[model samples]
Target: MNTVRSFGFLAKKILLLSLITCWGISGHAQEQRPNILFVISDDQSFPHASAYGSEFVDTPAFDRVAGEGILFMNGFVASPGCSPSRAAILTGRYPWQNEAAGTHASSFSEKYTVLPDLLEEAGYTVGYTGKGWGPGDWEAGGRERNPAGPAFQDEELTPPHDYIRDTDYAGNFRVFLEQRPQESPFYFWLGTSEPHRAYEEGIGRAAGKKLEDVEVPDYLPDTPEVRGDLLDYAVEIEWFDRHLGEALALLKERGELENTMIIVTSDNGMPFPRAKANLYEDGIHVPLAIRWGEHVAGGRVVEDLVSLIDIMPTVLEAAGVEHRGEYVMTGKSLMNILTSSEEGIVDPSRLAVYSGRERHSSSRWNHLGYPQRSLRTHQYLYIRNFAPQRWPAGSPRRIEDGQLTPMHSGYHDIDAAPALEVMTEQADDPYFNRYLHLAVGRRPAEELYNIKKDPACINNLALDPEYEELTQSFRERLRGVLNKTGDPRVAGDGDVWESYPRLRGPMREFPAPEWVLPVKED
Candidate 1:
């Protein structure tokens, strides 16, 4: 009996060895451990995918992922904006823990631990294509190489594309997969630049997307133009989904699909006004799906209060590693929930999911930003904008392709798009100007919304005397989370802008405020 058992164990080891060589890597630590294939999408909102019930576009690949694994309807980002959210994911710590990484332009510090660095130390071959954790300082974070993996050799690998075409993700992923070692288990992050701004107009229409099929959210006016724009965004999302499909197919062909853990999610919400930069549902809420064949139950929906920060811990746990104390990380591993028949490990409505934004770019000289802290529960949404004086859309700096026009087609805030046009015209009337307060005008210290009833958020219940009690409750809740999480907004009096640094990007000087004289003027 002992000899038979030994033979069976040896046979399994030999089979594993054969599979390892095929993926260009070697054997893993254990049979139960699976390689992580994380896919991150940029600027995608939950409402854009069919799995989350988006009327705008059809996401077959994303749906396929959800159908084959677990779909998280309540997935959210740690920050309303990109840089901070990503920092939280990679560091396994809140934005607050990441020093300057808390806000945009606040660089990530090297003293902190990082995901790729940690995984690489554990003997995983970590290679990333598309977007790696970014929009901040990875080099300063002690990530000397682009891959930032422990196994990274600067001469052998290059940083993934900073400027990426929607379809380029698959090609980069292919290269990463082809270059990996068969014996070494891998962790590959497929960051896709999709559904972000600067997309070709009419792309969705070209994809056979009907204008009528798109559901215009209440924030934007329902019009052919807006619908068309949304469809265009959908086209890019579908493009991203195709990349996922291609990667999955390759994994299957290599016989590593079953042993690979897949996580598909987006960085933040759609890049639209009152959404992207703001701490609204459209800004923070996102779609997420996880699949680990024979491990995570298929066709399950977990409506839990999970944030992007949780992803790092979950990945560590999935890799058969334990994250012990002494490291103050707030993220929780969802491994048990994924593998179990449990409906939802954590209640979606149990706690308030918090998000805030700091300096995004060097719109101003002093790194002034529309800092805000928000909490979203099952019913209500609360926001505390620290810099009510600063423009939430941005500091009115002309961006070339972003907020600037003509040469770049400045798209948001003051754009002539149908939605903005309609809303702008509405401001002409006294009623709408007040309503437009929700859109652009200066907000109070606290803004509250009952999302269940007013999804468009045209009304601010904070000022309404009748809803004062509800508003106050949300305010207290927001403060409590801020206090517990050590968010600067609570004690900083929500003045996060005072501490954040300005962006030093190429467009820094171009968008310099008119009030400031150029060097030539001196």
Candidate 2:
């Protein structure tokens, strides 16, 4: 009888010890997950950082990350616009797949689970500073906090220029570090609302920026005003880089730099005419650099086609977190490429990446949006504009208080900038008229550009007889991807895109299209 009792006690002791051992192993594994530092700038383009050998802008922090880890040459965002681009990054899906969240200033549906929430569920403390997943109403979408994470924008500082945001991004990050539990891994988003628009006129000139340093794109005129505007943009980029450097310094001070995966990129291209809201190269192509200490092999440059959608999967994989939700992510993880030592086209199967837009601003009649889908490959960029009759850059006229306003009073799709102002005000001038047309011109149903020959996307090869076959093949490829992705535009529900309400920004008025006119009584 005593031997029987002794055996039962031994069994219980072994079970309890096994449970305690499992708990310790689980806790240690959670702690071993690397921290994530995601830094995104407001409106920046690829090849702007000094690391890319740009003469105008100096970004030592971005350069540092590139030098220490890997620099991606062909990094593209899912969309050219801010809200949709950010939404894509958070959800690991295309803009159109995100429903209202896919469009600008629309609701982020509660159905779409984001990265920050996933990280938090995996025992990671996640927070964000500065802009995070917005210019839209996340609260209206039933989210209690910003999609990026909880906010850490309590700290402020005097900005060098009025257009620059006063949010002290680095300082806010410091506060976040202080408040974070010592044992937990963290995910922090450092978003900078810089180089967007509304720069102090001639601030760059006042700061002793030389016009000679500016490299003007073929789309815009190479005049003093444009150069100065670009310089001011460079100044803002520097400010963003400065804050990034400070954040890096803090991590180093805490001895956390070695264990953190650092990602630096932009939401979209520069906020210039034919750039920000357009589906051109400058719009969707963005700079990307990632540093993961010893995990990612250092001092390499990759030229593979990559999208911001990949960021979500990369983060989840790095943290060993399973993506659990109703929807599956469309983007594949970059872990294979990051961990590989080979540079320049690490993934040969990554043939092309896709980008599209619905509405940028309330720029059309009845608040209609310009719907476009594009497929970009190594040498070519093919675009399919669904609504060819509508103005590509919003209508030129607007109705005010039930009265028609002056001609050229609109074009709200283009962000108001000194460069745009010059183009419009000097539209009558022979030299500037061409630029004005380029900025607010009507686009064909299909457009193609040889990206290698014309990165500015000035030459359209879609209509060229020599490229007709190529264009058709690209169109079919785009269709296949769109259909596979369940894009509404290709699924006969394309009109539903325009029906999504613009939840934020001013709703402008324009003359209704003929199709919408009431039939006359005979």
Candidate 3:
């Protein structure tokens, strides 16, 4: 019996070895292992590109990619925040499954294997330029390099505006291509730090962009300040897209365009008060376009739900590499959805998608996390906030050096921007108070919304008797999946997320809410 078991184990190992050895063989060698160029923009949201019919911003490069390949309408990130969302994309797992890597600005554990490391082992030359898997300490996590790859940021260029980054992303990419060996295939990550925050006021107008072209979201007022902010965001989006066009042109100049797979998307949503950190549609939904030349069909629009984490497995499969890690991937490959001739809903089984959040900025007392999990389908959206007692954003005002700010002042979770500043200054006004309430108000544990009717997620349907059954069904489905995936939130260890040390960002002190008194011990 012992001999038979030994023989079976050895046979399995040999079969795996044979599969790995066949990666670069015969006619399929170069054809199967195509180069990967992944371009990511910071804080851009869905329907922002010209291809998506937005009149505000013109993204010719993104449109060109869509014209030459597939355009996705239902693509989302794993988290609403940057660090954890990037970590999830690299590891191909949910944020809750990865220990410290799952939290914002925390160290990533080396125990979890990332896509670049796995591809490097499979003989692919991997590297990255600009911002990659960051805003956190990767070195403290025991990684000798950035999880994305080696750095190639030796070049610089003067940006159009003062707030924009001077890192010449396109020039750096060209440098990387020049340095790479001719015979070896490469995986390059082009992460652009654009459209994030602290925009030079009225720079968009200075650049000849009209404020009237900006389409304000329903959650925000249609004031000039809001329109100006949106225009500035649009300007930055165009800047990033311009670099993408240059990179695509470079690939064409080198005759690698046809064989290379180009993926263009963003890390998270726009940097607005309620959009970037909240689990609303604008927060999680992002723009996505892919161009694979002749390997995949062009001018295709797909409506199937896809997650950012799916990129890890999709790239691995494209390189003819197999996954052999301890942690399991929660995302499914989009190869079938991409290769099919159909336009929308190629996979009916992809009925719903899931997303979760751990911690964003250090905006609260004790750095406590307002953990949330959500489920999105074609018709409806459901969300569960674990700590309903805690403020959804942060406290109204923070304390410093024995000074006190007035009521409705803090809301630190919301990023500081012109629109946010306007909302804060005009909080007492009748017209702006409703919008302000939506951005920083507390709520029930479970909230539901009809996305088709309320894409902004302003109305809560969980307590509506008309949709009681539907809400209950979605709530159970969300909890069941979390339990199945061993989510700590439902696995009796949800508090572990709060225990993780926040290694970066300022730690602000906030007074206890005037409403809640201290609990007395028994």
Q: Give the alpha carbon lDDT tens digit for every residue of 1-522 in model 3.
A: 132343244345434634665443334543567899999999998989999999899999999998899999999998888889999999999888888888899999888889887776566667788899978999889987789977777788888788899999999889778766565677899999987887888978888888888889999988999999999899999999999999999999999999898999998899987788888999999999988988789999999888998998888778777676579677788888767778988899988888888878777777877899999998888999998877877878778886767776667778888888787789889788888888887868999999899998888999889989998999899999899888999999999999998898888787775446687789
Q: In model 1, where is the ten-residue run with the lowest total lDDT?
A: 151-160
Quick one: RMSD of model 1?
8.3
**Predicted structure 2: clash tally:** 0
Taking the tens digit of each residue's C-alpha lDDT, what string does model 1 give over 1-522?
A: 132343344345445655553332223445455788888888888867888878766778788888889888888887766677887887777676566787764466666677765665555666665666666656655556543342211222321222236345666556556656565567878877676666676777887889988877777756676788788778778777878888888888889988888999988888765677667788888889998898877888887777888888888777765444445578777766776776664443347567777766554434456677788877778888776665565443344444553222222322233445455555566654443455565677888888789866667788889988888888777777778877766566445446655443434423554455566753
Among all windows of ten consecutive residues in candidate 3, which has the lowest summed lDDT?
Answer: 1-10
Backbone atom clashes (below 3 Å) for every candidate = 14, 0, 1
How far is 342's C-alpha from truth in model 3 (Å)?
1.5
Candidate 2, superposed: residue stretches over 4 Å from native? 1-31, 518-522
Compared to the true structure, candidate 1 yields what TM-score?
0.81
**Candidate 1 or 2, higher lDDT?**
2
Q: After aligning candidate 3 to the native by TM-score, how far in Å is the CA of 278 from where it should be?
A: 0.9
